[model samples]
Target: VRVLRPLIDEAGYIEAIEDPNAIVITDTLANVDRIVAIATTFDGEAEMDAEVIRFTYAEAGTVATAISEVLGAAGTGARLSVDASSNVLLVRGTQRDISQIRSLARAMDTSPRVAQSETVSTSIYRLQFGEASIVADLVRNTLTGSTDLTNPVAASVGEDPANPDTKIFAVGPEAAPISPVSVQASIETNSVIVRGTQRQLSEVSQLIKALDVRRPQVMIEAAIVEVSGDIAERLGVQLGIGENSQTGGIAATSFGNGGGALQNILVALGQSNAAALSTGLSVGLASDNFGALIQALNTSTSANLLSTPSVTTMDNQSATIVVGQNVPFRTGRVTTDGGNVTEVIKREDVGITMVVKPRITAGGVVQLEIEQEVSSLTNQAVTGAADLVTNRRVINTTVLAENGGTVVLGGLITDDRLQSNQKVPLLGDVPVVGHLFKSRSDSRNKRTLFVFLRPTIMLTRADLEKAAETRYRRAQSAETAVQPRSILKQEKVRKLPLEIDGLY
Candidate 1:
């Protein structure tokens, strides 16, 4: 016993800190970090039938002591006995409590630490019972109704911070003088841990699983890529989108890869079964329009987020941002004489906000409610004040496309800027030298903005699970885990706009 005291102390320490079932997995292979146990069940008792517990790696000598300490704290059926020649844990128990021992072993195999570090991975959705909230109420009601189970010490819902839709309800066992050594909470992987006699834990696990059924998960990702003004304008001209008829500026235009040098590219895209480019091509001629294409091929698909059918919703609003400009306002007062007085005031213009709502149908059609407000200073004056004018545009329409297609929204937005240059004053305006000084120039730069959207539908969970498994297999099968650094000079690549005849 004195020789095993250190292992017992270590086991007690681990039980106090992390969940008892958490088997530590590390990159150091020589270190012994494996847990093995044989469980036996009898009439009313359970036992760990281990003759020896051997732990290799760093400080391996203390492993048996820790395992003995952990099993001892597990309550009634747990006894610490070991074999000297081969270090293996042996646990034995009565028929009724035998399942608990088996559960402990299984839990260790499925622990998050194990799954993440091991070459093969496996997991089942689990719910963490909440102490408060509707979920908690449900657990309480279920536990109370169950005849074989007693109330748990603690219960709470653990919701995924990134995805609120995924949640787990966790339950804790009643508090004993010393916390049970065998049944420990594994928080990293959100394991559902309940401590009690074999029967009670079994009852609670059933109830939780029955109430909380895992739903198929879908992940959505979006990116915003800003295009340079020069690139946007060139794209617009190549696509044959003329100046905006009403505003006398460039209006957003959509075209396909058809009838241009890019026609071959579109054919290639179709061969790859790219839904965004296949069937019909409604290309919106604007800045950042093709960003979705780049994003889909490189990052989103590679990350396994594109497995399910999903919906892509885009909201874009166009407005002018003005600074150092004064606009008009009015102040009115109701006098005691029952007469109204108004004073004109000039105020600096600030910014504007736009809000839009998107709706999707089962067949993948989308409808959007877009509202845009543009505020600017007016050239004309009224009531002794320069006027502040606001242009509000409201649009409600369905995207002109078939199901599972791409849609472009908010094309009216443009970054329109005006620049002016003037020579120096008086002397600079004189004769020959004045010619240089008196030079005056005005120029305008504009780029149209378009939002691209794609929606995918989630059908089942098997696809996502398979994709993850495949990725893991690929990583493991690779010859070298590290990517080889290139020694050659890399050239920056750009997609050149295609020209049709002499038009562009």
Candidate 2:
């Protein structure tokens, strides 16, 4: 009624009747036609229509309220309603009113608000080959330009007293601007949640790609060899004298009186002289004159291949191989209150063991940190207990070598010598005759140990296959060399006859 009252008054209508859904106007046809024409032309609503405008980004109720206020102030007979559930505006008006409402909605409905100075977005990145916590820390440091997690502000910005240009102001007119970035790790899911701007998130994603890659593997081969040699000689002469005597009595008796008359006795005494000479020589010579002697006692050369262990591990990872047994030794004894003793026994590995950590560099060079040990049980006695003793030779060092190239890590050379002479106190000093009364012995032993190591970087499947083939060939050769002899020939031999030629 309010919207149509002005038009009716200007057209001089006689009377008006209002109804729930319609309105009646009593006036001249001429005045009615004028009023209709003016209403249609001025309001641009020749016929009533309805439109539903669904909001994409803006709230429907808010937009509807604003449009309703504008229509009321402008005195336009347009009704607007909002459907909060569907986020739409329902307008009952002509085409012009609906069009205007759509324009207003478009202008108000935009993307979510973003701050100019501090805008943060959340993103999650899943890791394939890298640790979540470590990657998170790396991302945080890289995005924030700070290495120190405890104090990021102090670490990122610094001041120098001597240089005027190196001063950084935190709260002054010349203060530096810093961007905000935060990163957190979800270890259970193996992912990292980063909160930062689009630019920072992009950088974090790139860094993660570079860091999360498959690690290269290294195959290590070790050889433990022991060489030993021994030589000994002895020369001596001995002489002595001996005396012997024997006495015996024989009695033939028929009775006590007859035995006393027929008694016989026998006695013997003898003197004898003995002499002995001994000489021993051990040398590495092949001559017919001393072939027998040299074969009996000669310089012996022996080589012992203790162990050859091979292991594969990732770069910067530690791998260990033990080719022996663990032996228990008594370390201490404790007496209990009831006079019972308890011995504390510790088991130690007594054999060849090698532990290596290899790191491959960019230029096919391997850096190795190695610990090699060779331990064995010895006959040397322990003073306080019956526990056996052990001799351990260990080498702990680090070196660099080319990939697939063998390098000698370390070596040990040991020399042992012993000499002894024994004789009668004054006879040993008798120049030429001393040899006859003296004995002499000499012994010498030498041993050498060398450790060789080779590292092969396995970066691809082909490399791994090649290394495996090599190891297989080596093991096959070793197995063939130590194969047992055949007993089939011995089984074919016939046994000798038990009663051959009636000799039984």
Candidate 3:
């Protein structure tokens, strides 16, 4: 609700019907009045400054109409989000109507979410990962273009980044006198002629291949709910949100694992509920106080991270809940060779750490320590990658742990709706590799080396490239937002239409 603070401060609210007997207590609520007065002054100053603003009014009639329009517009907007961090009140429209978005803020009696100099960074988790990228077209023309590369004899080759270029550089065959790449440098005059380097030729071939028509295509997608900067940054130093802005700045100074840590995140989480967008889902990690995105940006490997709920819903059905898996610490991975092949959902379970301090590696891997409520499902050795995390198909595995999940990665995949206190095995969905990890209710029970015993997640470059090549077959399932569209394979070439002298 937009309120002309000056008018609002002077007028207060005309309470249902104006009372003739009541003293003209127009200037009431001292704190509110001060805020309104300052804001009112700023509003007037803005008009003189000619700042473009949608017209608004604080009167009842105007308020009603404006709300109708805003809600109506929001109905058509791609996504609408409201975030409150510290003093910043962020209202996002969509790609369609940023310029013309009008909010009924002025008509609102409550404190306006937005104020002047409201410094709010986008909810790109700017601190977690520190780079940003946007696909830009060439200066005046599209960059993806045609290229002509020649092989020893005349060859009008089709564009292929892996093939050798004919015009600028000559590419020797895989089986040539250049077999031993280090020996032939003494042959050419004006230009240096070094041979036997298939690797070098291969790289050059790849660039020449990229030169032809295909800009980095961006895929638009729905934005996910993310934690705010203030919270993500805190997840770094303290466990369970040690020092944060829940109790304003005071809570942070008294940082510890007890109530202090949870207090920061819970408060910030309650207040934040942040939202933003990108062409494709991206992770922007910014250094402390980095103004905006800098270089050193690479595509973030998409993790199944979710935070907020979608707003599109009606009465009668159900409420939407959003949750994000947080990984405040560094991360490592151990994969079961999930090549392009889809891993079957053999079985499912949620591993709940019945105890606190379930021992997460410093590299951000959580091992839920659950009480031995039930014996092992299978007789496999309850250790190593061979072991499995027990799973029970349920939500919010509840075991009264210190903190269910991290603010950076996400909370435990536990359910709050579980019957309390009765012994519950850590829920495990997978038939294998569950259980053996149990912890106290609070996470501060024990401290393990943060970076120790981190496992590497391996996928051969060839395997990954092959996976990327075949992605188009199941394009619908690819995490295209973070991954690239190039993952979609190009049309297969049947034969190398090379005409003898000039390979076409």
Alpha carbon lDDT of each predicted model: 0.38, 0.61, 0.28
User: Could you give candidate 1's per-residue lDDT for residues 88-150 as a string of tens digits?
Assistant: 445554533445544544344332332222122222235543212334355545554424233
Ranking by TM-score: 2, 1, 3
Q: Would you give me the overall lDDT of model 3? A: 0.28
Tens digits of lDDT, candidate 3, 138-252: 1001211232222232333333466555223323443222221211111222112222234533433343234332221111111122223334344334433333333433322
Winner by TM-score between candidate 2 and candidate 1: 2
Q: What is the number of residue pairs that collide in model 3?
A: 76
lDDT minimum window of 10 residues, candidate 2: 233-242
Higher-ranked by lDDT: 1 or 3: 1
Query: Which numbered prediction scores highest in lDDT against the true structure?
Result: 2
lDDT of 2 by residue, 312-380 (tens): 999999999998889999988999999999999999899998989999987988899999988888764
Which parts of model 2 have CA positions greater than 4 angstroms off? Answer: 1-112, 115-122, 140-182, 186-189, 230-301, 382-386, 415-444, 477-484, 488-504
Candidate 1 positional error at 194, Å: 6.9
Instruction: List ranges where model 3 is wrong by over 4 Å.
Output: 1-247, 250-311, 315-389, 392-504
Clashes of 1: 60
